[model samples]
Target chain A: MATQRILDFLATRRPDGPCLVLDLDVVRDNYNAFEKALPNSKIYYAVKANPAPEILRLLAQLGSCFDTASVAEVEMAMNAGATPHRISYGNTIKKERDIARAYELGIRLFAVDCVEEVEKIARVAPGAQVFCRVLTDGEGAEWPLSRKFGCVPAMAVDVLRHAKALGLDAYGVSFHVGSQQTDLVAWDRALADAKAVFSALAQEGITLRMVNMGGGFPTRYLKDVPTAQAYGQAIFDALSKHFGNCIPETIIEPGRGMVGNAGVIKSEVVLISRKADNDNVRWVYLDIGKFGGLAETMDEAIRYPIVTPRDGDAAEPCVLAGPTCDSADVLYEKAPYPLPLSLTIGDEVLIEGTGAYTTTYSAVAFNGFEPLRSYVI
Target chain B: MATQRILDFLATRRPDGPCLVLDLDVVRDNYNAFEKALPNSKIYYAVKANPAPEILRLLAQLGSCFDTASVAEVEMAMNAGATPHRISYGNTIKKERDIARAYELGIRLFAVDCVEEVEKIARVAPGAQVFCRVLTDGEGAEWPLSRKFGCVPAMAVDVLRHAKALGLDAYGVSFHVGSQQTDLVAWDRALADAKAVFSALAQEGITLRMVNMGGGFPTRYLKDVPTAQAYGQAIFDALSKHFGNCIPETIIEPGRGMVGNAGVIKSEVVLISRKADNDNVRWVYLDIGKFGGLAETMDEAIRYPIVTPRDGDAAEPCVLAGPTCDSADVLYEKAPYPLPLSLTIGDEVLIEGTGAYTTTYSAVAFNGFEPLRSYVI
Candidate 1:
């Protein structure tokens, strides 16, 4: 939902060109909600979600740690007042040079999914705390992360052992259920794998001290999602079931859930017409599309809530597309979006729940359009 | 294949990060090939494909016209020495203000797929020459452009008539067979539609001039594609079959064909590992992935030819991926690319057939990596 402040900002400022306007008040509220939901676990806010300086600064001031995906992200977090100890270089696939750069930047914690990555970190960031990511089926995720990321549980155990042998701290295990995960128990299956790695390492006299539960938290799109408290309770139960009374020190990396609802994209209808006079579906083209910032709609996965002035009017399914010349620029086609029939060219529309995974994914002048402009209010 | 100049430049410079090295000689050769192939057609270099200033300047010097998608591209073409008369505002989707801006910049050629778009152009850029785009099935394209772009052939006649009614020049008809199109006969069906629109407008007493045969020209990827001469012959035959002696002034928009084979991206292997001990495939993580400039690899559609130092050695299929936190960063998994077994982290790899649709599609800084760097030799 567009907050009253954001709505007022759009009404008054009316900045031209498709831009994302994010309200810091909403981000503050979301941070508080997460802190309240999982009081024990540390909140490592995923910087890749929306690395707007304002959001990072505010989170830093609020005593939140950062989960960085690159050396640049580490610098962004540090520049925003985060200490080196509060940042973790979290991406599993990293170049040895990038690992060295992160170490030079004073980042001590790293993520690994294989012995190759572990060796890179060991060679560069010696004595760093490392976490091995285990593969998850991603069953309930809207975007199923295929086996592109994490290694299997047995491989993770070997990776952690290799890290320990290389004189690095095999401090934890991690797994991402997947992005936009809605199922409350999705973490249970992943937690079982984490526990398996933990038990296997313990047998070899390697005591893992923490479980870095990776981000899979959902954001409200077109449908209602469970609250952060619901997820916290489910995760806590899973941790207790797996580790018994020895629940390890845990951390939650929330990217989308932390910032996905704090921003709204203000766009205008570029064109609206049917393919033919008798064509059932109307074609609605927006100044923004897949390349502009709505890349989450690639396979029509993230159905963003669109607000039009004529919401009360009758609606029909429209084939929505971006302003670019590329055919892949279509946002919603497999499942057409039902937009108000009264919508016409030049009408302003607010796309909500777009605060995350948008600005970062925007191409740099894909069709001579600039990267999606972002304004943090 | 990496052009000799590009290979020499990479070997000498050894750019630190993943970067594209384009040989101007290749582009010049391609321009001449296109000119020789379609002698009668005015060549409009699609600006959306690898709009490096050096390439644009060379094309402008060679007397090639431009197909611009937005105001920025129009300005770029003009800045590169092209006059407004030589540049076509080719994208069908446009903001009314953009049309006015283009007109103010002295552009007159425009593309329209519907009456709504025509009305916008008519209202803003009065007396502009507009071409109505008809739909193509995109049957033979590796990247099939869906119904997101053009309207049906029957409706294109109405669109052009509406343009005439609005006092705009009903210039001609346009259609795209699709991007990375390999079929020689693909243009035949689309040309048939274009002919029907032209005939329909001719009967209505509105003389349509120029057939803007939009780009579908393929670039060599993993397999061989027909030559420009072959496509030219096929298109000429189709034109004669459809329009007979009245084959009006023609224009060809060649994006990928002009630049795709002119450049190569130099990237390093970040890691090489398997999921489990029994896993059959090796995951080859590269410094570049879908976001870094390989977005055409989405759905394993454009399988770019990759060359490594050990290409002739024993080979096996590897799951290729980029160095990003996003799971979708995986380039090839459904059909993994065969790589040398000797491939390992730190080995240099060259991604060929990347001159077009690469730097433009690169994310500004997704996961904190800068956009793909380009160097024109």
Candidate 2:
């Protein structure tokens, strides 16, 4: 749906070279859709997904809370008119000063998966509501998170108990199935693990009041994905099954799922060439790449839907890449897409469903290529 | 060594968080070393390596040529007092306007791999000197380049002939053994491939005056690498064997080799933790990661030597990661290094020999974190 909007926007704006078109209306629609889908759950837009002020302002107007990964994101949300109470410091890793600054900025709720993080928060922001994130399989997500965060159920229980000992609020438990989650069962699995941590915490005389189902919602890219409705039903069914009668107040932090399908990237084909005797494979270089904007193509784990302006059939296969000098800046090569053989330099290509992660993850000065320009309609 | 210099600089600057320190003296020494090694070869410091004005200025004053890949880089070199004659637009893929802009800026030397690029150059800047880059195996390199560039011998010959037909000067042939090349034989193989294209061009009665060996010079990171003297001798021997009686004027576009050893990254260990019951693998998260500045950790392909301030022996194996919320930001997992187990939050670690690709390849903002800031000492 965003493709048509982006096409219309491009027709009017005539923006040039690797531009990201973010529709605030579409963002609002996604927010409203999430609100309706998870009626009982609090929605915090993960600001790291797309920290654009325009998008944040629209979300703020809709009374959406924010999951801030850093002090900058907290500021971004606040500058967009979000109060500190409506923001949660979501990232587990933080410098002591960042924690102090976030506390000074009025953010009370924080998520930590390690003892050091909890200790830092306890010292800097006393009695702050803390959520201990439990480890997950991180399976079935297009962008599987690293084992960089989250702790085992036992570790989570210990960390939460430590938080209580350090005079911080032993508030809740959180988990991420991973980014761009596909398997609905992933939530069921992660929730079961979370419930064990909750039970273990209760056994240690700590009563948890909240649960954050960290974002992992998927978008339709290259393939038809489950709708937000399905995700909502799956989450509700899993929560009901896991928590039984003791269902606590719930929070859902949806980053890519909320805004992913709301934006489109308008990039131009820079060149198309066959290296040496590369008979079967043709390389189609775009003005955008890993550094440019399409970094979610991390190992082709998240494939975006392509829409070219050309009328001819896109029957010929070609390896796709970005314009940066880095070889890894390539978008796709092994699983080549059926691009039009007639496509050449200056032809426009629209990569759809890149609303999230594109603008935020760009490597600004990689190859002196300009950071992807964005317009919010 | 730059270690003592960095320590001295850090003693005074006291820069906190992750910082890239580029040393101008080290750059000058590197330039002199390369000059001494490859006496006959023209040195074009690949500007994409580290486009810092100080580094550029030092190289410019040393009478070095620049291998520019973008309009901005072309301008950077010129702003650093490098004339267009001393800058070769090395990137094969370029927009027509960029070609025109480069030409207008007085850059005559260009690199092209295909017919279309040649056509653009011929139309935009007629009779411009064009170098045809041939395909290489891209083997034995930490950062394996994309097949997005260069063509085979026959294809290169045809493209050069087409350039001649279009009134563009098909001036030379070029090849990249790949970046951070370890196996010295890779250059020999690539040079051999370049020879075929060169011989074919001569059969068409076209003489190539310049042969550009695109940058792939290695920097000592985690292991001992060959010296600039050794590389110079190897290149000379290879050129003598390949071209026999008539060797073309030589050019070496070194990015990492020239600057990689001259810069050091001072990053703080953000958090160090292990998953529940995971007594085996300790995780040491740094304020820097793939996005922050250590992007060469492409599947642990390029390992930078770590120098920590800990007095104890570094015998503990740990997974390294960036401070970003992305799961994929894990730097090293399987190939765990013996980082000191006592390493904790705020512990400063120096990643040495990271001058070239580190700053240039850093992502602008991945998790609301600032881009990698560099200080030239």
Candidate 3:
């Protein structure tokens, strides 16, 4: 939802071309909600979601730790007033040079999914705390993570043992239920895998002390999703069920959930017409597309709520597309999106729930369109 | 195939991180080949494929016209020394203001697929030469363009008629067989559709003079494709078979065919490990992935040939991935790519046949990695 503040900003600035307007006020509130919901778990704000300097500064001021994917993000968080201890290099895939660079920056926390990555960290970032990510089924996630990442739980035991052997702190286990995850039980299943890794490691004389529950928290898109409070309750129950009274230190990395609903992309209807007069479905072309942003619309997943000025009028399903010359630029066609029947050319529409995963996914001058411009106020 | 010049440049420059290195000599040769193949048709280099200023300058100096997708691209073409007459606003979807801007910039040619787009051109870019794009089956293309672009040939006739009535030049009919089209007969089918539009319009006393054979040229990837001579002969035969020697003014927009094989991307293998000891497939993580610049690997459509220093060693199938934290960043998984068993971390690999459609598709720092840096020699 576009906050009144964001709407007001758009009304006043009247920015040219398609751009993303993010509300810091909304981001601040979302951060507070997550903190309240997960009172015991530390919140590592996923920096890849949206690394706008203002958002990073606001999160730093609010005492949120950062989950970074690369050395650049680690530098961004540090530049935004976060100390090295407050940041975790969360990407399981990393170059040895990049690992060394982060280590030189005084960051000790790292993520790994294989013995090879653990060996690199041992050679470079000695004695760093490392967490092995366990694989998840990724059920109920709109943007399901594939097996490209995490190793299986059984492999996790071996990876952690290797980390301990290399003189690094075998931190804990991590798993992602997948991005835009909706089912509450998704966390319960992943937690069971994490607990198994913990038990196997403990029996081998290495006690893991943390469980980095990777980001999967949902953001409201076309439908209402579970609130932060609801997710927090579900996660806490899962932790208790798995660990009993010995709940280790926990961390929740919320990327989309933190800022997804906090921004709106204001775009114009570039064109609207039927393939033929007899064609019942209309094709609605917008200034923004997959390359411009809204890449989550790939595979018709993560359908964002579109707001048209003619909202109250009768609506019909229209095949939505982007302004790029590439055929892959079509955003919604398999499942036509319903828009007002009276929608015409040059009409402005706001794509909501776009704060997260919008700016970063934007291409650099694809088809001569500049990267998605963002204004954080 | 990387020419000796590109390989020599890469060997000498040794640029850090994944970057594209292009050879201008190859593009020049490609342009000459197209000219010899379709001697009667004007060559309009599709600017969206790879808008590198060096490539554009070479094409412009060689008297190549440009098919641009936006006002910015039109300006890029003009800045690269191409005159306004040599540029076509080839995107069917455009903002009315953008149309006015291009018109103000002295662009007199445009592309449209519907009456609504024509109406915009009528209001802002009056009397401009407008070509209506007709739908094609896109049958023999690896990247089959969907119905996102163009309309049925019958609707194209109406679109051109509407353009003529609106004081615009009903100049031509255009159809793209689809990108990376390997079948030489694909153009024959699409030309049949263009001929239908031309015949129908000629019956209504509108003498359309041009047949814009839109880009569908394939670049060699993993598999060898037909030569430019083969395509030209087939297209010429189709024209003779349809128009009976009274050929209309013709244009061929070559995007990929012009530069796809002229460039190569130099990437490093970041890490390599199996999910489990028993797991047969190695997960080979590269410094680049779908978001980084290999976006064509979505659905494993465009498989670029990988050149490893250890190419002669025993080979095994590997699940290739990018360095990003996003799980969707995996390049090839459905059909794993075979790589040298001796390939190791930090070894540089060359992704060949990637001169075009690489830089523009790159995300702007998806995980703090910069866009695919390109060096034209």
Candidate 4:
């Protein structure tokens, strides 16, 4: 559906109902931008972001590889027609069964952080190509993966050398810059770190065949965040220049950066009340709460765009909250929106940029709310 | 299962894997305490807190009313042998289908907050006993429900009059003191407000039959928070003094206060890493992340008790986190635990008080982690 048609269909629904309306036009545009930025590198649409089968199918049809974190995500991608060779199980925590399933399904590329994980993977699937995830010393990223999953530079070399000695193909080096990363320089630093690891592995007589720059490209939540294309280009350029002729096949996993902007939660304003102390301060409550797609608001303190469906003369600032009985169900504090000419009890509010973790990591049935319906344009 | 048996069972499983172990002994004890505290009042086990069917059955066996917020919860309670009169459909955001389902299933008591809701309930089940949810101006509660679903005090009276005028039995006044409420005085103040409303309704020739003091009793989180029994007795005493012989049948909805301490999440310590600059400060990452029961850690900035199964020697403080790739998945910061004489790669750590919203709310399939398995004692 076109954006206008999707909005119109949603507007016709009960104004005080909770629903997730996905805009495929913007999703395609985002995909194309990533493809354009890193022309040589393969873009793996991270299924962990928005794993709706329809969205996955669309990305698969667009010739994008899938970055699956779990067996379920890999199954979802495969069900969506993604080829096995195009699926990379990029999570560090590998249970023996999950590794066996991934290997049996022809998922060749696996991300390994610890020696125990690599050993487990080797036991399960000896032929699997593994990427030794290296921890960058670089700080000041939004969500550094080094704290939990990645091995240090010295440890990475040791792990890779051990993997090669054990007859497992240590195929690549992977590092996550971080989630919602604002600084593009972080990727350049991460790539430099990757190159150093690559050189170290070469001295240990291991041939690395892939350079996986794990997903953390910034999505536009607020205006100040850089575009995904600009972020992708910086990493692509750094990898190309650093490795020169020795560069392996490049892979970029774009999770939230791709889908976050393509979806909006269209909910009806169920209740509106003015604060007794400050009459000017209004709290507009929607039918969806923190249990719905708005769980991101609780996690990241992100306030998405709260907009009116129809154009209005002037926008007034108001607090937007979910209908659940929790005080923490707030979506935005004093968000500005176009005021309706004559506001009624059941006005509609669009919470935009909710495609990523909204449905994928939601608790829909807590207050007996239904799971959101997904559609493709 | 008894607490000891559950712990033993957890100790035997992938004693090194992440899992939630619910202590049925503590749960039953808490249920008995609530029954004793609210001797004259009907105790509704708010199923939203911990929606395990076994728990519902146990509560029902203990002669507790089931406070249902959705059709599924109602069905769960009804399947557990809770009668229609023992169930209260308390959620304000009632979809037409849900209301109709409740009516068909013989659910009698309905909590209405707005004019639309009143009309919706009347149209669906005209014979249902309706309660006008009055918004209280009580302060210092953790989660004030007035902001979401309650009608203003005056509007509540109007709603009652309107319902009566429409030939609907608007039988009571209800208000929530809020969740995680520390101040016991807030209950007294809210009850005082309820008494004034009851008197006003009586003067208008309306004999209100029920006065619901909605759930917000403190759980065993912090040292300062009161126990469920203490909070329940405080409310009961306040209501008894204020209403005397004119007191209606009281109702209490206790969600987290009942199930909060009834369960513990048993997880294996997957990785222990120290910051590069600070070797003394260590972070222990468990198999469970925010996608599991540790979600509350991010929301409330509160940590649960992290204990080892084996009785060890001296205790040491360390940061605990989940196994997911997200950095915000930390369960506790600087949490003290006994350092085992021989702590190795796969030591077990049990996180207590995760029974409420842990399993039901935070089971997102990230990184192929297995969903929690529940075993009743």
The candidate scoring highest on DockQ is 1
Candidate 3 residue-wise lDDT at B74: 97
- TM-score-based ranking, best first? 3, 1, 2, 4
Per-residue CA lDDT of candidate 1, range A248-273, in tens? 99999999999999999999999998
lDDT of 3 by residue, A1-377 (tens): 88999999999999998999999988998999999999999999999999999999999999999999999999999999999999999999899999999999999999999999999999999999999998899999999998878898999999999999999999999999999999999999999999999998889899999999989998898788898999999999999999999999999999999999899999999999887768999999999999998888888888999999999999999999999999999899988999999998989999999999989899998899999999998
Clashing pairs in 4: A1-A377, A15-A268, B1-B377
Q: TM-score for the second chain in candidate 3?
A: 0.99
Candidate 2 ranges with C-alpha deviation above 4 Å: A3-5, A311-314, B311-314
Please report how far candidate 3 places residue A128 from its true position, in Å.
0.7
Q: Would candidate 1 be rated incorrect, acceptable, medium or high by CAPRI criteria? A: high
Higher-ranked by DockQ: 1 or 3: 1
lDDT of 4 by residue, B79-161 (tens): 99899989999877666667899999999888886666777778888867888776665466654444655766767777777
Q: Compared with the true structure, what per-residue lDDT tens digits does model 1 show for residues B164-229?
A: 999999999998899989997889988888888888878889899889888989899889999999
- The residue-level lDDT of candidate 4 at B62 comes to 88
lDDT tens digits by residue: candidate 3, B256-305: 99999999999999999988778999999999999988999988999999
Cα misplacement distance, residue B34 of candidate 2 (Å):
0.7
Task: Report the TM-score measured on chain A for model 4.
Answer: 0.89
Q: Alpha-carbon error at B235 in model 3, in Å?
A: 0.6
